[model samples]
Target: MLVDNHCHLDFPDFAAELDAIVARARAAGVSRMVTISTYVRRFATYRAIAERYHGVFCTVGTHPHQAAEEPDVTAEELVELSRHPRCIAIGEAGLDYHYDRSPRDMQQAVFRTHIAAARATGLPLVIHARAADDDMIAILREEMEKGTFGAVLHCFSSGPELARAGLDLGLYVSFSGILTFKRSEDLRAIAADVPLDRLLVETDAPYLAPVPHRGQRNEPAYVAHTAAVLAEVKGVSPAAIARVTTENFERLFAKAVAAEAEAGAA
Candidate 1:
């Protein structure tokens, strides 16, 4: 089975067919899906979706793009909200210089707040980085020095240096559908170098659909295609990619794994 470690099921694009989307994902062999949060304010919506779906989980945080809108959100607030049974991670948060939708300083502040929440809660942070590799690396290194936290570079399309820095800091590297793009040979090279245990796959759904589905609305189901390409890049079979990524997902999102076990026992 495969696990889509990052997606936005709360987005309106899937509203009319959310149940069908989850069903399709399961049919496509996606056993789990982490529906990421982009706004801490709308966390209840994310939690509701996670509760509505059996294999779905959620996170809590403000995205870099929305940093200015919720600049005052604190680590304590995130930690409190993340106590939900299905809220398995801390963020889809980090720097996004590409859009500059939010002030850089505000973004950095909110990002650090999420990191603190992750550190306190022992939840893996779902990081979203773009066009800010140097700052991202510096902040990550500085934060690691302050204290260790579990995290993954979600939907990674960054340079090798940032990848190396994240791996060096013991963070997992999660690839999205961008890996299947024809122009992504450089990304494939990075994926190839990521140790099997440190690699993950995501869809970032409602966006970045893989080949054969590119330009279409992405869903957790298409994570398999990204895994297929990653398998080819790693010179392993698709099944191996599935097993390894699922294991990596469980390890990184250990809260979700424990929740599943608890539910099974119940």
Candidate 2:
């Protein structure tokens, strides 16, 4: 089964039809999904959704855009919140120069905090980077020097240099519906080169829906479209793509896998 490794089921857009959305995702062969956290304060919301759905999981962190709002949120706080049985990762946090909603310095500080949380908790960090490639590369390199940590460049849409930096540092790269756009040939080329073991697929739902479903509100079910396109780009069968990405998801989000195992045993 395929896994939509990253999504936002807690978003208001899916509020009324949350159950239907999960059902549709399962119907589409999406056996697991992680409803990402954009604000640590909303950890409960994300956790509740994860608790409600059998195959859903959650993360704990603040998005860069909301960095300024929770500037005081500490790595300790993130680490503590992540102890929830369903919370599997840390931070959709990083630089977002495109929006500049939070001061660049504040964003970097918050990102570092999340990185620290990842390092301490041994949970993968879900990074959100945009138009801040240089800083992202620099920060990742500098942070790696400080200590190694697990992370994924989620919804990646940056330059080859940033992608290369992440890969070189042993970070997984996740592609969203953006990978299926006609104008994303460059992105497809990048995806083609990413090692299968380190590749992941996501919907980034309520946002970048793939072609044929473009302009529609996205959900976990639509991850199959992105996976199909990725298979074409990687010269593999769709089933192979599903197998590789699901394996990658379990590797990167091991806590989710362990949690499932424990639930089954019980």
Candidate 3:
């Protein structure tokens, strides 16, 4: 089985036919998926998806692109929302200098808020860093000193230095469908260096679909293609990559699995 460690199933692309989307993911060997939250104001929409599908899980966060819109979202509010049994992680939050959709300072502030929430709740943070490697690395280092927190450098396409920094901080690194692109040879080199136990795979679906499916709407089901690419880069069988990454997902999101099991028993 494969676990897509990050995706956005609640997006409009799947809203009208979410059941079929989930079924297709399962049929494609995607046994589990983590639906990412972008805007806190619409988190309930994300939560509803998780509630409806046994294999679906979610996070509560404000993406950097939406940071300006949610400037007042306090760490306490994030911590409170994180108490939901279905909410497994703290963010899809971080710096995004690529677009600068939000003010840099505001994005940093919100990222710090999410780091606090992750620390408070003991859940892994899902980071979305882009074109702000130095700042992201510096903030992550500072926060690590203040307190320990779990985090994943989601959809990593950064330089090897940032990857090393994140791994040094004992955080996991997740590869998205972007890894499957032929132009991602440098990225693949970085993937090869990352230890299997610290690695994860995701679709970031409704977004970066892997090759053969590139330029199309991505889904959790396409993770297998990324996995195949990662396996090739790491010189391991796709099954091995699947097992390692799935184990990493369970370990990093331990609370989510436990919460889901408890809900089942209830």
Candidate 4:
């Protein structure tokens, strides 16, 4: 079985056919998925999605674009909300200079709050870093110095410097459907360097759908396409890539694995 380690099923894009979307993912061997929280105000919506499905999970925190609107959100708030059994990680949050929707300093401040929540709750932080690589690297390094916390660079599209630094900091790196694009050879080169134990795969749907489904609204089912490309990039069989990433997902999101085990035992 495979895990689409990051997704956003709570988004309106999938609202019309949520059941069918998840059903197709199951048919594609996506046994579980984590619907990322782009806005903490909608954690309830994410929680409901997790509760409605057997294999869905969620994270809690704000996206960088919405950081300014919810500037005062604290680690305590994220920790308390994460008490919900469905919550497994913190923050699809990080710097996103590509859009600059929020002020750079505000994004940095808010990112730290989510990082604090991750450290406080002992949950992995689902990060999204874009064109702000230098700041992203600096913040990650500074934060690690303050105190270490688990994180994954979701939908990775950064350069080799960030990837190497993240690996050195013991952070996991996740690939999205973009890995299957025709001109992502540089990204594939970086993927090849990431240790299998620290590797994970996601779709970042309903966006960045892999080739063949490019320009289409993506779903968890398409993670297989990215995984297949990742396998080719790493010189392994698709099953091996699936096995390693599934293991890495469980290792990082231990709470999700625990919840799944409890449900299985029930």
**Each prediction's TM-score versus the true structure:** 0.99, 0.99, 0.98, 0.99
Cα lDDT, all candidates: 0.94, 0.96, 0.93, 0.95
Which prediction has the highest lDDT against the true structure?
2
Clash pairs, model 2 backbone: none
Query: Candidate 4 lDDT, tens digit per residue, 1-266?
Result: 88998999988899999999999999999999999999999999999999999999999999999999899999999999998988999989999999999999999999999999999999999999999999999999999999999999999999999999999999999999999999999999999999999999999999999988999999999999999999999999999999999999988999998998888898
TM-score of model number 4: 0.99
Arrange candidates by TM-score, highest first: which order? Answer: 2, 1, 4, 3
Which residue pairs collide, candidate 3? none
lDDT ranking, best first: 2, 4, 1, 3
lDDT of 3 by residue, 62-175 (tens): 999999999999889998998888899998999999999999999999999999999998999999999999999999999999999999999999999999999999999999
Give per-residue lDDT, candidate 3, residue 227.
96
Model 3 TM-score relative to the real fold:
0.98
Per-residue lDDT for 92 in model 1? 82
Can you write out model 2's per-residue Cα lDDT over 31-60, one digit (the tens) per residue? 999999999999989999999999999999
Query: What does candidate 1's lDDT look like per residue over 70-99, in tens digits?
Result: 999999999999999999999989999999
**Candidate 4 has which clashing residue pairs, if any?**
none
Better of 3 and 4 by lDDT: 4
Model 3 ranges off by over 4 Å: none
